[model samples]
Target: MTSPTISQIGEISLIDDIRKQFSQKLRDVTVGIGDDAAVIKPREKYLLLTTDMMVEGVHFDLRFITAYQLGFKLISVNVSDIYAMGGIPRHVLLTIALHKNTPAEFVHMLMNGVKDAMTLYHAVLVGGDLSSTQDGISLSATLIGYAGKYILRSGAHVGDRIYVTGSLGDSACGLHVLKKMKRTVSLNKKNARGSMHSFCKKLGAMHGGPARSGLSWKIVEPLVRRHLMPEARNPQKFIRDATAMIDISDGLLIDLTRLCNEGSTGAKIYEEKIPVSIEMKKAAECLGIDPLTLALTGGEDYELLFTARQGKRVSATCIGEITESQRVIVNASGKERPLSVGGYRHFQ
Candidate 1:
C-alpha cells in the first residue's frame, strides 16, 4: 500500500506528521517546533524579523529559472524586508514544501543559491523544516536583522517629500518578456509544421521572437535576471534623514498608498518624475505597454521608497510630495488626477 498524500491528510495532520522532522533546537532558539510559537533568547539590541512567501506558479516560473536562482531570490526578498526597515539581516529560517520526486541535486542547487545570496548580505541560515506536498513547490523565508533605530511608515510628516531608489517597472517588464517569449516559443513549436510554419514564424518575430534575432536574448536576459534576482537597496546615509521608508514589493502606487495611509496623509507624485531604465523602456516598447503605467502598477522592484526633507543628498529621485489632503494624486503634463492603489494583490 502507498502512503497518503499531504492533501489527503489535511494541513493540521500534515503539520503534525512533519513537525517531528525538525526536532533539533538551537541554543538561542529556546523553543522550537510543536509550540504555540517558537521562542528565542532575549537580546539587548533592536531585533528585526520579516517573512516572505513564494508560490511556484504564482510568484515564479521554474520553466526559465534554475533552482539556485529561485533560492537566491527567496533569501534576497526576505532580506529586502529587513533593509526596508533600515536594518541589516543576520539570520534566516527557510521552510519549503515540494513534491517527493524532486531530485536531491536540485535541493542542493537551491541551497547553494540561498548560500550565494546569504554571502552577499552577510546573513546565515540558522534553521527551517522541509515537508512533502502533492502540489507544486512552496517556499517561505523568515529573516532576522537588527538596527539601532527603527524606521516606521507612521513616522512620515505632512511636509516630507517622497523618494525612491533606482529605476522602477523593470521587474514587471521582465516578467512580460519572459512569459511572452515562452508563449511565442510554445505557439511556434505547436504551429511550426509544413506550409503554415513560415507564417507562424513571422508572427512570432513580431511577438517577442528570439530565434530570429540573437540580439533579442542578449537584450532580454538582463531584464529577466532583474525579475529573478532583485536587489535589496542598502540603507546608508539616507536612513538618518528618512522619516519613513518601505521597499517596493507591490507596485509603487499600492506601496506608497500604504505609507500615506500609515502616516495619515495624502501624496502627490509627478509622472515624469518617476524613473525608468532604458532597458525597461525597450521591453515596454516591444510589448506595446506604457513604461510609466508599469512603473505605477508593476510590483517587486525591491528598491527603497522613503519620505525625507528636501535638502538630503542621497542617491534617490524625488518622485512626489506628501500632501495634507486625504487622497493620493499623480501629476502628469498639466493635469492632476486622483490615484488609486494598483499592483500585485494576493487574491482578486
Candidate 2:
C-alpha cells in the first residue's frame, strides 16, 4: 500500500495538521511562526527574530548540493534577514523535515554547516525539532538577534542617497547554470563523463578549479558561489545613520519599489550607476537576456538596499536621490523614464 501524500491533502490542510501538533502556549514567546519569527522579550535588550524556510524543489535541488552546503546556505539566508534589520544575531533554532531513509552522515554534515555558520556570526544554536517527511527535505531556521534601534523600510527621507552592498544578478546566473546542467544530464543519462554526478563535483570544485584558457576564473566562480553561499553583509553599525533600509532578496527595482511604497516616497535611479558583475554580463550574453533586466528583476541577491544622509559617517555611494514625484524614475544616457515595479509574487 502507498502512503498518503501532502498534495492529496492540500497546502492548507498540511498547515492545519502541523499547527495541531504544536502546543498552544510556548514560554517566553511573544510572537510565533505565523510571522517572520517568534519574538521573545528580554529584560535588558530588545529582541528581533525572524525565520526562513528552504523547500527542496523551490529553494534547492538535492542532486547538485552536498549536505554541508545545504546546511550553510540555510543559515546564511536567515542571517541575511537579521542583517537587513540592523541586528546582531545571537541564537538560532532549527527545524528539519527529512526523508526516512536519509543517511546519518548527511545529517552530521548538515549540523556541521550550521555549527560553522553560527560560530562565524556569533550565533548560538539553541534547540529545534526533527521529523520524517515523505517527499523531500525541508529546513526552517529561526534566528534571534538584538538591536538598539531597528531600521525599517518606512524611514526614507527626500534627498537621501540610495546605496547597495555588492553587485546583483549572480544568483540568477547560477540558477541558469544549474538548470542547464540538469537538462544536459537528463539528455545524456548513460554517459559517465557528462552525468549529473560529474556536474555536481564540478560545481563543488568550481572555486578551486583551473581557470579556462582566455577566461578568468576570478571573474566566474565568485558569481556562482555568490548564489550558493552569499555572505551576509551585517550593517548594524551603519544603521544608526541610515534613513531607510531593505534587503535585496528580490531585484533592485522591485525591492526599491517596496521601500518607496513603505516610506510613501519616490526615487530616481541611474541605470549607469547600478553595479553589474562581469559574470552576470557573461551569463546574460549566453542566455540572450538583458543584463539590466536581470539586475532589475532577478531575485535572491541578499544585498542591502539602503538610503543614507549625504556625507554621513557610514560610507556609501549614491545610485540616485529620492524624488518628490512619488514615482520610480530611471535615467539611461539622456533618456529618463519611469521604471515599472516588477518582482516575484507567489500567486501572480
Candidate 3:
C-alpha cells in the first residue's frame, strides 16, 4: 500500500502526534489543543507573537553561510517582526530538523548562533524540539514580545508620508554577487590553478581594491554579508509617531501593498527617493541591472517602512505620500508609472 500523506493523516491525528511528542505541558497552559483555544497567563495585557521558518536550499545556501550565521539570521528576522510593531522581544521557542547524519559540532555551532542572537536582543529560549529530516535542515522559530504601546498597519491616512529606514537592495545585490562567486568557483575547478588565481586577481582589481596580484575580498564581502547576515530595525519613532508600519521582508512594493491594503489607501513614491547602497550601486552596474529595480522588488531587507505625517519625521527620507486613490504609483522624471505587484511570493 502507498504511504499516507499529511492530508490522509488528518489534522486531529497530527495534533495527537504532537501531543504525544510533547506530553509534558507547561503549568501556565490551563487548556490544551482540544479546546476552542489554547490559554496562557500573561503579566502584561498587550501581547505580541510571531513565527518564521527557514529551509535549506530554498531559503538559504549552506555553501556561502556558516551554521552560526544561519542561526543568527533566523532569530534576527523573527525579532524584526516584533521590532516593527515597536515591541521588545522577550521569549523564543525554536524547532529544528536536520539530517540524522549531521554532526553534533554543527548543531552546537548553530545553537551558539541562536544564543548569540537571544543575548543580543535580550530574548530567552523558553522551549524547543528536535527532529530528524531525510534531506536538509529546516528551522521554525516562534518569537513573543511586548510593548507598552504598539503600532498597527491599518492607521495610515492620505496625508501621511512614507519613510524607509537606511538603504534598500543591498541584500539582493549581495545574493547576485554570491551567485557570481559560486559560478566562478565552479569554473575554477576545471581550469589550471595558476590561471584561475590570475583571473581572480584581475576581477578583484576591477574595483578599486589593492592590486596585490590577489583576489580582493573587501569589495564583495559587504554585499555577501548583507545576504547571509542582516540587521533588524527597532526604533521607538516607528511606534510613537508613525501611523502604520511594516518591516521589508517581502520586497518594498509587496510590503507597501500590504500596508496600503490594511489602511485602505494607496501611495506614490519617487524613483530617486528610494535609497540604494553604494555597494549595491557598483554591483548592479556590473550586472547591468537597474539598481532601483532591485530596491523595489528585492525582499529580505528587514528595514522599517512606515507612514508618518510630514514634518513629524525622525531622521528618515520622505520617499512618497499616501494617496486617497486605491492604486500605488511610482514617479520618475516628471512621468508616472503604475507600480507592479511583482515581488517575492511564497506560493505563487
> Could you estimate the TM-score for every candidate?
0.79, 0.76, 0.78
Q: Write the per-residue lDDT of candidate 1 for residues 1-348, one digit (tens) a residue.
A: 544544455556555543443345456567666665567763427899899999989887787567887888898899989988888887678898978667655666677788789889977566677777788899999998888887888778877889999889888887776665463222122432443344334534785673643224434555666787777888784556789998998888888989988888888888889999877776676667788888887888888899997676767888888888755455565577777753333212
Ranking by lDDT: 1, 3, 2
RMSD in angstroms, candidate 3?
8.5
Each candidate: what lDDT? 0.74, 0.70, 0.73
lDDT of 2 by residue, 113-229 (tens): 777777788776555767779888999999888887778888888888888877877777766665555531221125533344455446434534322312233344555566666
Candidate 1: where are CA atoms >4 Å away?
1-44, 183-204, 207-215, 237-239, 326-328, 342-348
lDDT of 2: 0.70
TM-score ranking of the models: 1, 3, 2
Candidate with best lDDT: 1
Give stretches of model 2 more than 4 Å off.
1-44, 183-216, 236-240, 343-348
Kindly provide the TM-score of model 3 when superposed on the true structure, using C-alpha atoms.
Answer: 0.78
lDDT digits (tens) for residues 1-348 of candidate 3: 544543445445644554453344555445544455455555455789999999998898887677887888899999999988878887677788877566555665577778778778877665566677888889989988877788888889998999999888888877776666563222112443554455445555664443442343444556666666687888674436888989999788888889998999989888889988776776676655678878888878888999998778477667899999756555566577776675333212
Instruction: Report how far off residue 276 is in candidate 1 (Å).
Output: 0.2
What pairs collide in candidate 1? none
The positional error of residue 3 in candidate 3, measured at the CA in angstroms, is: 34
